[model samples]
Target: MLLLTAVACLLNTVVAAGGLQSCLHTRLSPASTLVSPSSAEYPNATVSNNLSWQYFASAVVFVGSAEDAAIAVKCAAASKIPVTPRGGRHSYASFGSGGRNGSFVVDVTRLQSFSYDPKTTYATVGAGFRLGNLALALDAHGRATPHGTCTFVGIGGHATCGGYGLTSRLWGLLVDQIVRVTAVTAAGDVVEASPSKHSDLLWAISGAAPSFAVVLSFTIRTYPQPASTSYFDFDFGNFSDTPSLAVKALLAFQSFAATSAPPELGTQFTVGRSAGGTLGLRLSGVYYGVETAIPTVIQPLLDAIPFSPISNTSKLQGYMASVAFLGGDDPVNTTGRVESPNTAYEKSIIVPTSAPLSEETWTKFVEFAFNTPVPPGISSYYWQIDAFGGSYRGKRTAMAAFPSDANAFGGRDGLLLMQHGTYSDTSGSYPAGGHAFANSFAGTITETVRTEGKKIEAYQCYVDPLLSADEAHALYFGHEKTHKLKALKHKWDPARVFDYPHAF
Candidate 1:
């Protein structure tokens, strides 16, 4: 009779276990719809910018509101399952969807909503609003906020990660424009962060966003549209034979940017392999003043070059039109091309004004661009150098909202940001060798910068997946600030619930 009772008790335990599994697999919150792997929405929810890092989630919580997001976090905590919040899904390192083995992804793209207060000159923006839609909305009000060039990138990631755009020099980083942010904490509490409230989280989210909390919305200070804007494009064809002249011209431009270029001017220099395997350099930017001022600012760069540019074009247009023009899109309407999913690897570094540009480093960069073997469907790899010292220069010390001492962004002290990128088509599987070569080339460039140019820091937004947590912390936050970030992290998320590659 005892043996019979033991068997019956064992059966009852199994039945209870199965019932608990059924309950856990179903909806966890009234505000969120939990979609299992069997649901068709699972595929779309798991998509990321880089196909190489695509992952399947155990379940996706389609959060309808910030309250729903809070509930979802609580559910994940109860189940002891990891959770990641996804916005536009544009993380090159796949921080949004990758590396979360069987984790729950809270899709916040459904929370896109915005409101502008004309009197206060502040716009309350939903975290899920894409840059293009936000741009249009602000343009309707004759106001604008500084943002990144890519249109499809979500405001949450961009602003939190230190957004930069054509007007960033004149204004400030997207984070600088933010007056307030609302986020859901790891403790499953909805909190508002700003200079006055939950201030530590506010400082951390300004740059190291993914490591802190799930941002729900931001209140950003907006500026009135510029009266007139002008743009100039200069193309310097194959510099293989006359590389010296190109170098001289580049240095001259850099000098002008550091010493002469006004806050209203923004410039980007690109060096890459053009069609037919020829090396080329292109300089492009916009001036916030009238068309007449273009000559005064750009003439010094023109004079430095020994040879004339193959093409030079300048035009006057509205602020939004200039944005479209700079993005290589239609000027009448400020809409950028929707970037399709493709394989890409990027490395970015901050070049301080003190770092001297050596001939060896320049030659090495040129040779790598020309000699790197492109894959079957790949077109070309490129480098972009953006000027940063302008009105932004003062914000490093003057901005009280995000005190310079506590801010996590590492590029504020640099004169320019140099980005190296490798591109591959999405039509076929990404070649393993191609990615390897790109990483090698990027490492070579970084080493050269450190050994020759004496610049050891890198931009945090261009997150590299291969970096060790320690190395990434130093690169992104510097030694002093990294310690502060760690203390804050321990205070808010002691369990390290929100994590990814290079996360704080």
Candidate 2:
């Protein structure tokens, strides 16, 4: 029923208006810049990476402009080589790992650019633009987009994989604002996908992996700047002792946030390493308007588990500055950057909004995440859940292609359950052993969650390889939607030019 046709694309020399020669040129005059594998800068270029905690590509091609990227993609096609687009590489999955298949790495760093059309209220951004840079750019214009807390994370890939962050409760999703995308299709054609043109391609790109093509730029809808943004933090040492309290707190806050939380207020939850050796459970947020109304909105959550007020720096700063605080000032700035030389695998699940959260599942999850013995440098994470529902609750357009029950995703107004197991060091003698350990831990968690009668639909880019095809389908597209996705794959990338490890 599926056709994996390998169509041969014909290269051409039609230069775009006043640009450089196309990839079909025989003389191959070097453009403004080119970092080849044999060049002196190759070693350094190949090793560069954002935080995702792994190394991947053996060779890296740092593309400077869309034209340069177009050339690279064309060259790869001509040479019969595979290509992987590189952004922040922040995912924990092997999605960007190129592996040993000799996939040419196309790094979009040189494509970083951000500009706005005030009249239209849109931000035309380069594929390489990180949330931090974009936030700074947007702040200059008194405009903002719902880029997540990690400032340095790439917006290109983030938008496609249904970008989310603390602000999700306020702005819906980062992808919701996407108006148009300029990309090079697998067929070697430079095209634009948007609501007006190539709408289906646009649909496939959002909430989907980079299977359609290599996106060079995205033009997204922007919103007026909020009057002010606020931040809050709380720390609890032992997670297991307050199960009932935490549940009651979570439930009460969920109800309040849905009905009464000021539209200006956006909240977040995080359970991980904090300022001290203490592993903290913190609830922090941003208020788009006056901060005076936030305390009332979050009071229910606060009442559940009172702890030492580690630090509460609530202020009326620009969105960019708020992003800096949310991302925190870290050494590697791992809060939002991608991993270089991508080496690890990422896994995530969108827990249904209506799906019941059993005490058994919660207790088991907390134990595995906090009590599990993680390798020294290696780490795992659990995101804050306080930030959900707001404008993001009813974006049926976003769930258009998602095979699962839209309601299951917290009733289409669901809270996303994000988790990842990261390996910081892959060169040690215990490399295989470390992977085995993480896998075992993950299996236990998955099994336990399954035993409780819940399902996990992963972000396409974060589907775990350990899952069998059927298992992956169930985890990713829900039981019924997986088949439809396969059909989409057949309709678009029949030749599988954008294929990666199990990217069907």
Q: Compare the candidates by lDDT and give the number of the best one.
A: 1
Model 2 TM: 0.78
What digit string (tens of lDDT, one per residue) describes model 2 on residues 295-351?
A: 776675576554444555566676666676677762223333444343444455555
Error of 2 at 271 (Å): 2.7
RMSD (Å) of each candidate, 1 decimal:
6.0, 7.0
lDDT of each structure?
0.73, 0.58
Q: Taking the tens digit of each residue's C-alpha lDDT, what string does model 1 give over 113-139?
A: 789998899999888788877888899
TM-score per prediction, in order, is: 0.88, 0.78
Deviation in angstroms for 6 in model 2? Answer: 24
What value does the lDDT take at residue 202 in candidate 2? 74
Compared to the true structure, candidate 1 yields what TM-score?
A: 0.88
Flag regions of model 2 displaced more than 4 Å: 1-33, 48-59, 97-101, 239-263, 273-279, 306-313, 330-346, 367-386, 390-413, 421-449, 460-474, 479-481
